[model samples]
Target: MNGARGKRRFLLALCALAALLFGALGVWQVELPCQTLDLIERVDARVHAPSGPIPPRSSWPRINAKSDEYRHVLVRGRFLHDRETLVDALTERGAGFWVITPLRAAEGPILINRGFVPRGRASPSSREAGQVAGEVTVTGLLRLTEPGGRFLRPNDPAGNRWYSRDVAAIARARGLPGAAPFFIDADASANPGGLPVGGLTSYRLRKRLLDVALVIMTSPVTVPLTILGALLVRITMGAPVLFVQSRTGVSGQPFRMYKLRTMRPLAPSEALQATSAGDVRITRVGAWLRRFRIDELPQLLNVLKADMS
Candidate 1:
């Protein structure tokens, strides 16, 4: 009888442990969205408007990070047609190649991303299509030049395949001289057909700061409170206590972001849509999750996993 009692206790303990873990998972999922929102709010405040005379090469924001270097700068130089780097680039506006060319500015040879040209127009010959020539005044944010290459794929200098904006690598590859430490995002200028353009730089510090703030809020304390809330919802309801969906992150990368299950599952293979307050699909529990941001806690795990990139 004692042995049987002990066995029962062991099984109960195991069940309790399982319950604890799932409860924690659910809560963590809920807290993430709120945290991320906060982070982004904070980063947006300071990321734009430039940060003084631009930090030296060492202090510039690293690859995939922000830097104050892009503060307003003025440079007047002639475009050096000989060496140009066509980089694979995607912008808030669209996807295309950035025409990064050396400009023989009086200050030095600063790299310039002339603008976005579609796939067909990525070649130097495209410069003839509508090139900005002569001693032009270029004014815009100075983004710290990306060096080395992109994650995973190393830059191939031989065949002229570049994944990132590593200025040093480009200089080495093209055997160019006096390359500036940074690159300028040229401001919008007049062009024909009113398309395939440059100088459409939009500055928004408010949005970026919010993103950074949200990410930071997903720290330890807030995550626990979220888990407690998930436990209450689960005990009152039944199965399907969590919801997961895929989202596109930086660099067009996709990852599954979790939330408290807020909507009714459609046909098993159905696609998800953005949730609206008035949508009939949202459950009472899900509505609460959305309101208090209990549904977004799972993304903390994603951030920890480095999946946000």
Candidate 2:
């Protein structure tokens, strides 16, 4: 009788622990959507805040994506019209070219995406009125360097065809070694003839009701499974269970992507190697998680946050 009573108590305690774990998981899942909305609101506020002076030369070394990206800034410089590069862009006004001109600022050369121009007026001569020769003041948002090309289309410097505004590559191609590490997206303030439309930065909604429905139906099973997978990764791979990587999102925007850590750290060159099913860097638990697609469960949070679809 005592043995059966002890067994009953043991089972009850196990059930209680499981309930608490799942309860906490459910609360976390609910908080995720709220947190995502809060983040978006905060970023929107930052992007629209009163304009500030451009960071000086000394501050350039310290500037980073987390602190300075999308910052509204005012800069005084002269446009190097001869060195401008036109990058292909698709905007609300339709397909166009981004007029990226090098501005000779006090600190160094700064690339200003003056704005977008329709294909018909892509040449500097076509929009000559807007091309101010002397000193000019530009108000715009500071954007980070977009390395590599956009998606599968790489920037062909030799062909003078650029799919993305890769600052360093553009500088190298234009022979402007002193160009700033970042670029500025000029504000909606009008150009001389209004040829290139400024102030066109806008975010479009990509989420649909069907997407929310799918998340709702699958989350119950996936959430707890994710927790279990996290625990397993912690025990097997040790610290840093989650790996975050910068990924290009819709409209060529950059966003962080999160996933379960699945491989051992490697040097930069080695890390670039392609991996297959039997890659040796993959952890034992990671291999199992990857096999069942359990590693991607955390990205559901990204989808909830509207960073991904």
Candidate 3:
């Protein structure tokens, strides 16, 4: 009788533990989902659109030049010849470069992303063939200039290498003053064949698997074990299990963003040289680490570090 009673107690304790863990997982899921789009939406609410004609000259947004509030300006300007900068860009089509030309606006110089050109268009002939001349009207999304380069690589103006659409950097490199706080996303009608394939602006938020997984670890042991696994991976790899490269944030300022690294360290220029499944450049441990997202544990640190802000 005592044995059966003890067995019943054990079973009840197990059930209670299971219930507690599931409840904890459900709570976690409610907290840490992808909030990028949520933050974007909140920002969008604060930005009031321009009604009717452009606001008075003095009423324009102040240009410490570091806010997305300046985006979506409808400006009329002429392209400045010989001052165009080709920036490295990627698109759904393929990887290539962009033709960011300065548009001489009455108020200030606004950079216009003319369009995308493939690697084959890496010459003057290709640029000339696609150049649009004379007075023209362009209406596209105004993006705040991202000054620094992309993926932690600094923009080397001397080498003509650019990876981000930082207007201030480009303007400074081109030796132009009075540059606008933002750049325009050239519409499809402006340069259809241009690199980056203009009109590639639609962004949708997707539910991340990590968010789901974390939320499901409701069991007390499961949550702690998962967290322990993540911690173990981080301890094995050094401080940053997830690496945040300095990316050009809105309006030419620098911000660090997170990503999982699957490659061994190399010369800065040689970063992210693509590796297939069997590539030798990846460490055996890192490869397996990448597969299971043990490499991504550092992003929790990133999140705690408030790098996303």
Candidate 4:
């Protein structure tokens, strides 16, 4: 009788633990939207706060996404129209490109996302009127560098194809001296021609909610499985159980795509070939992971990071 009573108590405790665990998970998932909304509100507050002078060159080292991103700032400089680079973008008006022009500020050159232009009006000549020359004051929100290429397509400097507005890369490609570490998104003030529409930002709540749902539902199952898989991969294959590659995201933006390493490290030349069923390059554990689609579980993190859905 005592043994049976003890068994019942053990079962009840197990059930209670599971209920608590699942309940916690559900609460966390539900709070995601609220957390995101709060963040957006904070950013909006910063953006609307009284404009301040652009951070000087000496302060560049300390500036980061947390401290400076989306902060409204004032800058006066000459626009380097000749060196402007167009980054692929998608906005409410449909597919377009951001005209990124460098502003020759006193402290240093600062890249400015002048505005968005539809595919038809991408060329400078097409939107010549809005291309203001000479020194001008620009007040807008500062944005951090978006390094790497979007999705599967990496930034191709040689071809002049850029997906993300990577400040360092753009400065290097444009041969600009003393370029600032960040860029500025121009405000909604009307330009001469209205070709490159300023002050356009993209946010899709429905898509974000859907992505959150996917991460929440799959994480409980995938998290532990991924950990076990990592251990197995390490034992069978060696260290470095994961691999990260740059891939394009929404609106041709670039983001890092994460995945479990599924094959032996290969030479640059050998890595180009597609894997066959009997290929020796793939490790035994990698083969199993690929077969069961277990290798893709880590991408749930990318979804959480808003890089993928």
Write one digit per residue (lDDT tens) for candidate 2, span 1-309. 999998688667756766898998788678865665554555566568998888988788788876787788899989999999999887667778999999999889999999899999997889889988899999988888888876567899999999989999999999998789999988889999886788765332213333554676687798887877877776577778898888865445567788998888767987779888699999888898999999999988777665566
Q: Each model's RMSD to truth, in Å?
A: 8.0, 10.5, 10.6, 9.5
Candidate 1 TM-score versus the reference: 0.57
Over 4 Å off, model 3: 1-71, 127-129, 190-196, 203-225, 231-309
lDDT of 4 by residue, 1-309 (tens): 999998688667756765676677667667865676665666767777988998888999899876788888889999999999999887767898999999998988999998889999988999889889888998888889999877676799889998889999999999996899999988877888886777764234446656775666666677656765776776577778887887876655677788888898888998779878889998888888888888988888888887776
Q: For candidate 1, lDDT tens digit of each residue in 1-309?
A: 999998688667756866787677678667866666654543444335443343344443352334344455567788786788888765665667777778886556778777777777676665474555677776666767677766565678888987777888887777766666678776576444332366644432333443444555544555565666566456545456666777765544466776666666656555456656588877677777778887777666665554552
Please give, for residues 66-151, the per-residue lDDT of candidate 3 as tens digits.
34433444667788868988887655456677778888777777788866777788664765646667776766555666778764
Residue pairs with colliding backbones in model 4 are 149-254, 150-247, 150-248, 150-253, 150-254, 151-247, 151-248, 152-247, 152-248
* Cα-based lDDT for every prediction: 0.63, 0.81, 0.59, 0.81
Candidate 4 TM-score versus the reference: 0.63
**Of 1 and 4, the candidate ranking higher by TM-score:** 4
List of clashing residue pairs for candidate 2? none
Going through the candidates in the order shown, the clash numbers are 46, 0, 14, 9
TM-scores of the models, in the order given:
0.57, 0.60, 0.56, 0.63
